[model samples]
Target: MTETPSREHRPEPLWAQAAELISEQITRDGLTPGSRLPTERDLCARFGISRVTLRKALGHLLDRGLVTSSHGRGWFVATPSTVREWPNDLESFTTTARRKGLVARSEVLEQLVRPATLDEADALAVPAGTPLLVLERVRFLGDVRMALDHAVLPAALAPGLADVDFTAASLFEELTARGVVLDRSETAIESRIAGEALAAKLHLSAGEPILLLDQTIYDADNRPILLSTVEYSGDRYRLRTTFRPR
Candidate 1:
């Protein structure tokens, strides 16, 4: 007697297939991270899917952390990967993440434009009472917490910097667009015991090891323009740099 065997391989949902193809297209086009993708209507037309199906596909990509949507700016590629090698030359965490093929996302912990105090002014070599933009964020690689970064710069340096969405914006890009020349950066790194407060934010236990990085960025004129501190979670990431002797 011949009995029909039940089908063992099931077809993927149309939306899931669409999502896969869209992700492939992102790589095939060599799209840069943070670059906007085609509009939803255009994507649907290209993929031969309806708007509803397209939305589902996009949602799937969003869930996979491959794309982000701006209020009116359409979808942006979030292509990035892990960070293990550190560039000896100056670099931004955002750039490092992209170069290392890891998605970099940030949770804005603080963003303020306020008058600089005497200490802040002295650190940045700016006049006291000058408007300074303060930014703090918990940087992440995919779902893993990586570092807590704090930065202060003259508010006028980037006119609308305070309004940028730090979660998706890169400070270096903003500074460059504003014609701010980053000539050099002086940096120092040390190991420290994480305090209860920092641990709470970084998901580490009190007294855990953390790498503290202090840096000051200077302009082409050799004037200090920005001061930054980044505390990297020791368990999650290690800092490395190449050394060469002439």
Candidate 2:
């Protein structure tokens, strides 16, 4: 007869196990946003773990953005918001919103034909002091202010653009109607904190998170037609892209 072989069982890491348990507890208890979690001591005892292990578990939750902590206050569930995906495409904000079955509107804050600044001239490949039409508008999704857009275009490319009714039509559509075909765009996005003026315009608290998009639009002949700086409410939007391996 062969001697029986012994088997050893390996357990999951204590902190990971604790994290899962706490996550389940949060769900089971129906904790909503801003709901305070139990004290550290209470969690430690309940999980039958030391303070270090409990803290590790909580750290995991914090890293996942599922919870947040205050200096004197305890941890609380994070507020969740609807995420709007912005794909890598040459699409206008109005078109994107319409596709989502949301109403989009614009409030033109300023529109004028002004001499191009050095940066604008460089981006548009035009000489400094060239007249450019600048359009600044506040965008709204239904009733909520969503973004602010500042677009600069060569006046020679789009004559009478400064007089166009931006509030009543899409900028891209207007340009297309005027025989300017936008073929592609190069864009960069970064996170930013809202300043007092911007926050007031967007109806958000000062220092709120926002997304800044800098784009240079080009025509089929690789001629830069427009440069835009768009600021979006961070909580109300998200950027997503799909990639395929070559």
Candidate 3:
């Protein structure tokens, strides 16, 4: 007699199926940055799931930086964090970085709020005592440690960040879903001496040459969302760009 196929052998989870459907909608609709998703009732009806089940699927997408919701606005596909230049546009950091044949990943070293420093206060346009969530990460390319970065975000703005899988996606993508649109950014690059943290994270010896970068990112309302200072191994990465004056 032939044995019946077991339910345990099903290829995907219930929530996963729902997540896939929602993901497809975002792609098919060409959802842009700051686009809002349908309401919970709508998604539930569309996916033929109960409210509890729909929320479960939405939670999964949220953790993956794929969707976001506000108190009254409902959910929306996250706006992508991207950079564009003529013939050279990078829509996502991890995707673009990987396309350059480099391995890219992020570790959520820290994800809690701490009091901002004077510098941080000025950069974020907040008071010195304002609470901020800090994220420290090491970036690698082809088995070589490339950069060490530290990012700070307004604690109140990104309440769900602590639940994100930093190892899997870009922080900017996650922030946008939560309503923090990265409207503009400012960057400063210079050479610097490596510190103990940088030395350890990048596996470099002391007194080595390194590249230092200070980057500030702002929301659509012109409020600072993240402030980061990065240190790159002198021998590992290069910055190259061409410009045509207007």
Q: Against the unseen true structure, what C-alpha lDDT does each candidate score? A: 0.80, 0.80, 0.68
Please state the error at residue 58 of candidate 3 in Å: 53
Relative to the unseen true structure, what is the C-alpha lDDT of residue 108 in candidate 2, on a scale of 0 to 100?
A: 95
* lDDT tens digits by residue: candidate 2, 68-187: 565455776654433256556899888887877777789999999989999889999999999999999998776657789999999889677777888857898789888999999999
Off by over 4 Å in 3: 1-92, 243-246
Q: Looking at model 3, report the run of 10 residues with the lowest lDDT sum.
A: 81-90
**lDDT score for candidate 3 against the true structure:** 0.68
lDDT string, candidate 3, 130-167, tens digits: 98888877764434455777888778887878677777
Backbone collision tally, model 2: 0
Tell me which residue pairs clash in candidate 3.
37-76
Query: Which parts of model 1 are misplaced by more than 4 Å?
Result: 1-82, 242-246
* Candidate 3 positional error at 201, Å: 1.6
Q: TM-score for all predictions?
A: 0.65, 0.67, 0.58
